[model samples]
Target: MRNVERFIGDKLQERKDNLSIRSLSTNIPPVDFCSNDYLGFARSGELKHMINSTLASMQNHLNGAGGSRLLSGNTRFTEETEAFIADFHQAESGLIFNSGYDANVGLLSSVPQRGDTIITDELIHASIIDGCRLSHATRFKFYHNNINDLESKLKLAKGNIFVVVESVYSMDGNIAPLLALSDLCERYKANLIVDEAHATGIFGANGRGLINQLNLTKQVFARIVTFGKALGVHGAIVLGSQNLRQYLINFARSFIYTTAAPIHNIVAVNCSYQYLSKIDHQLIHQKITLFRKALKENHIKTLSSESAIQGILFSSNEATKQAAANLQSKGFDVRAILSPTVALGKERLRICVHTYNTDEEIISLVNYLKELN
Candidate 1:
């Protein structure tokens, strides 16, 4: 135990020396910019009202799920809700998991077999990387959003091929070339699995995600959508064929071994979806437009992204952290994505534009960024 403590201390000291040490911070700034709540649904009083009202009408609502979904946690309402969400997304079926991370792990870790090849984007999320690590399959990473590189990997792949990518990258704030990738996968006879965590409530007609918006739902083998982000709720759903849902139920250790979410959370997910369909998503796009325009006018460079998620790259972790600190001081909730989270020298400020941000706020934030520049 003493040796283990020394090892941990040494790792921490190394991080501190490099100015990349991470610590939980409760000191959130007043303005909104850093969160995944792009539609402002997470902070919506109306959505809360709907959740509370729905919960009130239900009888015998359990605070806890009591067990995993395969056991005592299995409820008719949960199954029905999953079906409803699946139908909403135009998927043949769906299965719910505790989080986007769990869904990614559960699906990726279990689906690909020993002889299979799992090809992923170089900049795919940590959860997907972890999942691929857990799999017995051969794993390969292609250059981010490079279709030609992906095709090269596909040619080298063996047995069953699984191509994985995010619809919207969380850190880089860029949308994947889904159309091109879908065509490439079809040509290679590879299954394309998309993680739509960042695109779930910001794209599509009713936020059905990028695949649905692009009419590629039928082409995708599977999609993992999360409620914690734009839906401003919790939990996640893996959308696919009915057989896939059953397979995850039997084999996804993350889903089978873990307890289910509480009744309130499930209810919130349902209510949030209900709220999603009625809201004007145009407001979010409008904010994004305003932000981009402001950045351009201020001559502040940012990553090329039309999505709600946006980024400004910095050369070093220290520079990124200091920029975040400066923004926090100005009461904007911007955050730095440092090395290790991203490759060294690719540190950035990951900014999220929301429907709730005012025109003045957008301009002010960009002006500050200009000053920083």
Candidate 2:
């Protein structure tokens, strides 16, 4: 026990020394720049009302799912919701998971066989990386958003090749070249898996995600969409063919072993999807434009992203942390992405633009960013 304590203490001390220690804080500022509530749905009274109303209408008053989906957890309502989400995303089928992390881990760890090869984007989410770590397949990483590098890796890959990427990368706030990647996968007869975590409820006509927006739903093999991001709810869905759905139901340990999300959470997810069609997503695009324009006017460079997520790179973790602290002090609620999370010198201030942020607020945030130097 003492040895275990010492090991934990040493690891924490290492983090502290590197200024990369992480802690939870409920000290959110009043400003609306740091959260994943891109459409303001997370805080929406309308969404809450919808959820409550839906729950009230449901016959099942059970607080919990009782067991895993494979056991007593499965419900008609849950299966119906999955079908609805799959159809909305133009997928053949959908399987619900507790979270995006679970969906990624379960899908990646279960599908790819020992002789298979998994190639991922260098800047893919940590969840995907962890998923790959659990897989028996050989793994490779291509340069971020570089098709040539990806093609090179694809050529070198053996067995069933799986190419994984995020539609909108979480940290860098950059989008994947899905069309090119899909084409490459087709050329190599490889499978393409897109994690649309940050894209769901932020793109497409009814927030079906980037795959739907780009009309690549038929081209891609699978997609992982989360409700916690722009939908402002909890849970995730893995969209794919009916066969894949069945396979995951039987083989995905994370889904088969874990208790299902409660009835209330599923109701909230259903309500959120219904709310997606009514959302003025254009408002979010306007905010993103306003933010970019403000940044350009202030001559403050940011990562190349038309999405709601934006990043401003800093040379060191200390500088990035200080910038985030400065923004937080000014009540902006912006946060820093430090080393180890990213590469050592690639630390950044990850800013999220939301539909609720006004033009004045965007300009003010940019002005404060300009003052950071």
Q: Model 1 over residues 1-373: C-alpha lDDT tens digits?
A: 6999999999999999998999997889999898898888889999999999999999978889999988888888788899999999999999999999999999999999999999999999989999999999999999999999999999999999999999999998899999999999999999999999999988898888999999999999999999999999999999999999999999999999999998889989999999998899789998999999889888888999989989999999999999999999999999999999999989999999999899999999998999999
For each candidate, what is the lDDT? 0.94, 0.92
TM-score of each: 0.99, 0.98
Q: Let me know the TM-score candidate 2 reaches against the reference structure.
A: 0.98
Q: Candidate 1 — what's its lDDT?
A: 0.94
- Summarize candidate 2's per-residue lDDT along 161-222 as a digit string, tens digits: 99999999999888999999999999999999999999998888888899999999998898
Estimate the lDDT of model 2.
0.92
Q: List the residue pairs that clash in candidate 2.
A: none
